[model samples]
Each structure stands twice: as C-alpha cells, then as structure tokens.
Target chain A: MSHKIGFEGYKHENNVGFFGKENSKDGKDGKEGKDDICPVATQVHHLIELY
Target chain B: MILVLGQCSDQVIGAFMHHCVKHSVDFAFVDLNQLGKSIDMDELYWFFPGQSPVSHSDITGVYNRFLDWPKQNKYQMDRLLSLFDWLDHRYENVINRPKDTMSNLSKPYQLDIASQFFSWSIPKTNIIMNTQIKIKSPFICKSISSERSIVNQVYRQEEKAFYEPALLQAYIPGLNIRVHACDDVIVAVGIQSDAVDYRYSRFENDIFMYHLPGQVEKDILALNRTLGLRFSGVDLIYHNKKYYFLEANPSPGYAYFESQLSRPYISEALVSSLSRSIH
Candidate 1:
C-alpha cells in the first residue's frame, strides 16, 4: 500500500498581473472575487512511465 | 427541474442526461451557443428554448458546463452577455456560479487559489511574451486559458515565431494523478501516457484507474473547499516521492474516465449530488 506524505510548502513569488489584465475586476491579479463562478472540475487523468 | 447548460454535443452533459433519464428526473439541456439566438429576458420574464420555452422560476437547480461562446454579431454578443450576467446573479443552486468561473478564467489564477490550501508545491511559473527569457530547458508551456495547446520545452522553434504571451512552468517528471471530488466523495485515477501532453497522446488505451492515499484525499477536499467548488478535477504529479500541485479544472471532461473506470461512479455520484441540491 502506498502512503501519502505532506511535502514542505514553498512560497511562490507574487507574480500577479504577469499576464495581461483580466477583462473584469474579479479576474484581475488571479485573485478570487466575490462574484467569479466556475463549474465543478472534472477530467481524464493519464500517466506515462519515464523509465 | 434541473437545467444543464453546455454545448449540445458535450459528452459529459450526455452522461448526466443519461443518469437523469435512468432516474426519471425532469431535466432540460440549454445549448450555450443557441442561447443568444432565442433567449428573451425582461424584468418579468426569462425564456430559453428546449422542448419548449423554459422560464426562470421553473428552474430549481443548474448544472453549468458552458465553455465557448457562439459566433454572433456584436449586438447579439452584448445582449447575450447581459442575459448571462442576469442568470449568473439570479441562480444560487448552480453547480458553479458564473462569477466564480470568470475569476478562474486562467490557469495561473486557478493555481493562485489552489496554492492557498494544497499541501504540495506548484511549479515555478512565469507568463511571458514569446521573447526569450532565461529559464531551464525541458519546461512546459501552455496558454493561460484552455483555448491553446500545451507544448514541451521552453524554447520551441515552432512556437518562438508566434508572438503571444504564454505560461511556462518548470517541468517535473513523475506519475500523473487525477482526483475527481464531488461533494464529500472523492475518486482518483492514475494515468500512464507516453506523450508530454497526455490529452494528445495516441496511447490512451494504456490509461488505468488509481487509488489515492488517505492524506492526499483529505488535502484534495480542502483544496476544493478553498476554491468554493463542490465538484472538481484536480491534477497532481507524484515526483521524488512528493506530490506537486497542478491547476484545478472547473469544467472537467469526465466522459473519458467514465468509459475507463468502473469504481469511481462518476455519473451516478454527480446525479446524486445534484438531486440532493434540488430538495
């Protein structure tokens, strides 16, 4: 059985607005606003072996 | 009544519609593209066509999977935006509120929110112009939005000619794990692909189901809560015995997994969750 372990978290440099300006105030700086709504995220997961 | 908002041909919505039929649930699908053609909205009325015109009060819950905007004249587009804005504000039991989706319009934005609660680290990412920047080789580049292709290597001769801003991440080698969480239920799968972008791989037949460890499951739930998403598909890479965080997808295509794995109960879980929200 594979066990999970927590890794040391690293602080990312705040690179807000590195991309162009978001069209709305909510999408600005990649910050969550009170209004921005998204649906549930689902996808197919595929893995490839490197060895 | 449940309203499913998405493209007419989306397989995910097709699966959801299948489940609704199996249970004899009353549901309707409103094609995202066709909305602008016939949607009639006034302070006193809301109209969308399916089998018949559906009114605002008739809808109890919404499962929104809309992705692309349809081609329309500028006046039509403006009108559709206004109508969408009204629906975004009026609906409360939607699978995802439209406003929240707007905030997560880009991968970097989603990563910023995921970093707040995830136990793992995200790759060092920079969104830069096609102009050369000093970065290690073997990094991956993708569009900030889902509208573009994902390419490996920071400096691809083909992509270098295109002058557009793109997101570049330090590539990590490891196994890919995708976790689908709906409400409190979590289903995880391991994917094995030979291509750098697994979605484009020809060896899709190699994909298989996977189980996640207990701690990792807990972290995923927390991450979903932080994003205010009750349903999500989370991507993680297990590298060097540690998991690295990838972006969280709001509208994930689950038909691939549904066809591959039997244990996750993807469509059933979604139906049950949505059903509960109605009552």
Candidate 2:
C-alpha cells in the first residue's frame, strides 16, 4: 500500500468563497443598508499539484 | 434548524438534508458561490467582529460542508472570511456553533490539543507566512486560513514563497491517521498511502484503510474533549508507530469516507448522533 496516511481529500473540506454576481439572500439589507453592504466569502479551495 | 452553505444541490449535503427532513429539523442553505454576486464589496467585517447580532435565533446550528479558501485574491478573500465571522455572530446562539474553518484548521492545532490529554507525538510543523529564505528540507507549506488551496506550494526553501506570505510547516514522516471525533469520541480512524501531499494529489488506488489500535483509541478519545468541537477530522502523521500531529481539518469532507472507502456508515453515525436533537 502507498501508506499515504491521514488527512485525505474529504478531510480538507473548507468554505471557498465566491466572487461573482449576487443571487438569493440579497435582502432588504441591500435596499435598507445600502451603505453597509459588502462582499461575502464564496471562494472554494482545491489542491494544485506540480509533478 | 441548521444553515448549510454550498450547492443546495449536492450529494452528501442532499443526504444530510434527508436526515433533517426525516427528523423534522429546520435547515437553510446558501450557495455562497451564487450569493456572491449581489453581495456588497465593502461592508463585510473581517477577523473578530465581536458577537454577531442576528436578531432571530431560529437557526439552531450550522454545517459548513463546502470547499473554500483564504489568503488569496484580495478582492474576494476578505469578504469570504467576513462571511464566516458574520455567520458565527448570526448563529452564535445556536446549539452547535462552528469554529473558524480556516486559519484554525491545521495539523499543529490538532497535535497540540491532542497532546494535552493523549500520549501522542505529532511531527514538527511550521506555519509561516513569509516566502523568505530560511526553511529546512521536508516541510509542508499550507495556508493557515484557506482550504486545499491549489495555490499552496510546498518547498524545501523559503526563498520561492517568501515574496508572498504562505504557511510553512515541518513534514512528518509516518502513517497517515485520519480520526473523526464527534461528541468527544474517536468515531473513526483510517489509514491511507501513495501521495506525498494527499491534500493536492490524487492516487486512490494506492490508498488503504484500517482501524486504529485500541490503546491509541483510548488516547485519542481523551484528547477529543479538549477541542470542544462536536465534529473534528483529526489528521496525524505516524512515525515508528508514534503519531505526529499534522492539522485538524475542522470541516472535513465526509464524501471521501463514503465514496472512497465506502464508509457510508458515517452517515448513519451522523444521523444517530443528530437524532439526539430530534428527540
């Protein structure tokens, strides 16, 4: 066996943020707190290997 | 009700949703990828923004089962991190709150926490941001605040990475031990192989799975209480039968347990555990 152990693909699960146009959850806060609104985290992370 | 952030249309999540439905628990999901568009660019707060001010406490918990990153793309990174913090505030009063998925997810934290109560020794590690020269051979460079960043580049030298700040840590040579801790119990431990950095590589054929020894289990379970986390994926590197701490993937991927090793029993275990809340 490769003996490559522990933290594998699934274990690295995280919350990658987004950087695009908005969708749902864009609420009255957008219309109400116009000056207070800002961007949200949506970028996803993946392994980029170099062989 | 639990709030999930990802593809409302995913398999693992879908399965989890089924559980919620079966038990009549409330849940919410927001595709941050899609939700990003309408999001404002300057208002979200980063780091600790104090306690969240969500008026409604309807949401009793949160499950962050998504693949995300940090420390890159100035325009988006801060915003995403802010979201987590925001949710932390929003869901702060929930029964099961989530810790910072990034920055806090590292092998060193796991080892450190595990060492407090367990008789285990993880490999030496370094979490540095400077890409400057001054690194020893066989060290893993990971982002303290990002997921499996395709951008994470490990090196024997610090020169190449110093230009831009990245996480650098010493490498541990040992059997990989992925232990799942829920409710302060070592629920699962499996072994694998074949990739230098499994986080960024794909070699399933070479990977194998095994149960942890009993004595080791005792030590692991004892350490679980220290984390104060309802869920934790503990990844450790083992050398000479001794475990060297790597990082604790807080919001680990459950799909691997089911998809790769066919440990679908995890779903049942989760269902059974979460069922406690249902009653």
Candidate 3:
C-alpha cells in the first residue's frame, strides 16, 4: 500500500503528524527523526499535471 | 540549505520536504500562518515545535511557494513582509521570486505574454461588457482573476451585470495539454475530458504523459526564461494541429498528479536543482 497525505487534511500546528512518520512510532526526537537517512529516494519526472 | 515558505497543508511543499528528508538534505519549512508566533523575526528564528531554533543565515536556496500573505495584524504582517524582503535580497537561488510570481497573477497578462512566444498561440479573446457585442457562438467565458473558474457557454441576454469585465474567447475544441517547466527540465501531459473545464471532471478525465515536439519544448523554455520564472505550469490546447496557449501558473499544485498518476514531479528535480546550486 502506498501511503499518501493530502492538502485537505493538513494542519500547520500538527505538521509532525504529517512528516514525522518515524517519530510517531517510537516517540523519538522529531528533528533527529526528520533527518533519518534514506539513501534510495523516489525520483520521478519533473512535471505532474492532471489537466 | 533549502527553505520552503507556504501553507503547511500544501501537499506539493510537503512532498518536496519529504524528498529532502529521505535524501538527508538540509531543509526547513515555514508555515505562513506561523509568521509572528512560532516563527519570529528579531534576527531570524525558526521555532519548529520540539525542534531547536534555526537562523536565517543557515539557509542558502529557498523554494518560495507562498501564495498569499497571512491575514494577521498590520504590524505582524509588515514585519513578515520585511523579513521576506530581506530574504529576497539575501538569497540568489529563490525559485519564482516575488516579483516574477506577482506578474503572473492576472490571467490576461499571462496569456498576452505567452502569445509573444512562437511555439504557442491564443484563442481570439475579448473583454465582453455589453450584450450587444457580436461574437461566434460556443465561446467560453472566463474570469480575468485566477481565483475563479467561470468557464461556461455564452448565453445571449440583455443587460448583463458584471462588476468587472469578463473574458470571452472562441472555444477551441481539442486536447488539453499542460506543460510544467523548471529551468531546462520540462514535463507535458495531455488531458482528455468531456467537460469544457477538465478540472471540474478530474476523476473522469484521462491523463497521459506527453512528448512535446522539440520546437514546442524550446518555446516553453523560452517563455519561462522570458518571464524569469524558475518553475511554472502552463496550460495549452491542441486544436487543428496547433497549440493555443492558455495561462502560466507560477505556483502550480502538482500533488494530485503525483499521487493519483504516480508521476515523479518537482519533488526530486527541485532537491537536485537546489542542491546543485548550493554546491
């Protein structure tokens, strides 16, 4: 399953809930969790338009 | 360091930030709503909840996707504007600088600019004020402001009321093509829809990655360069073996296409481009 977040449900006060997926599991430091390294990142085309 | 300025709910900015995190790249995001509260500007401080404060000098390149200023008290807004102005002068690799982005707010102005390019053409357009005006039928009406989408069939009536003149253009029936360009990198998609405005029927529309003719690609690049935009989403129509330019969007919303269509968009390209510029 591909995990995705949408603009409709995002809240500024709770950005960690959106970006801090790793921290959510372990209750680790948000900053450190944010910097967790994943060498193989998804790379796609530079443009994406629906219509 | 890369800085993203926009709404926290903005999925496009969120995705780009994710890419940066996965690659272990230095980046920071400032929600416009947190301007005077969480993000203070005595000298530049970023107070991400639970994270240590960061300074502005740490940032090098900024990906500015801030569409509108926050509706805060006048003093706070002025302070935020001053901070933005300072950043504008400090950073050299800011994508879609404020001035360049502001120029594209008007749809008519952008269409006029796109018309000047050789690879694109525009539909016969006019600002209709009176019902007495005569024009071909099946024309589409659009709002001059980008805030609204008023694409509707032209109906003949007496005493039409418009606070501002509405745009009327000869409706060209053809494939809708959207081209997104970031510097030399460009991606074009063809949209097939039954509705006049494909955006209204997004789920029903069919999307396919398009390969643009070399000349068309060059022309788009030229248009981007001419407008001094590092990234832009351009709308066009393919009719009668010709392309009709629509408008240029300085801050395009690509999250829908990225998630639904599974296309690698500005996410990876933006990181690499910003990283390259910094190095």
Q: Score the docking of each candidate (DockQ).
A: 0.03, 0.03, 0.03
lDDT of 1 by residue, A1-51 (tens): 211000000001122221112212232212211111233233345885658
Compared with the true structure, model 1 gives a TM-score of: 0.72
Clashes of each: 18, 46, 2
List lDDT for all candidates, in order: 0.61, 0.47, 0.65
Tens digits of per-residue lDDT for model 3, B159-278: 344446777777888999888787788878888987777665424568788888899999888888888888777788999999999887777665434443454665666766665655
TM-score of each: 0.72, 0.57, 0.78
**Model 3, chain A: how large is the TM-score?**
0.18
Q: Write the per-residue lDDT of candidate 1 for residues B71-163, one digit (tens) a residue.
A: 778766666667566556776567666555554567888788767764688888878875755543667777776554545344433333325
Superposed Cα deviation of residue B245, candidate 3 (Å):
0.2
What's the interface RMS deviation of candidate 2?
A: 17.1
Judging by DockQ against the true structure, name the best candidate.
3
**TM-score attained by model 3:** 0.78
Cα RMSD, each candidate:
15.6, 14.0, 11.2
Docking class of 2: incorrect
Per-prediction TM-score, chain B alone: 0.83, 0.63, 0.88
Best by TM-score: 3
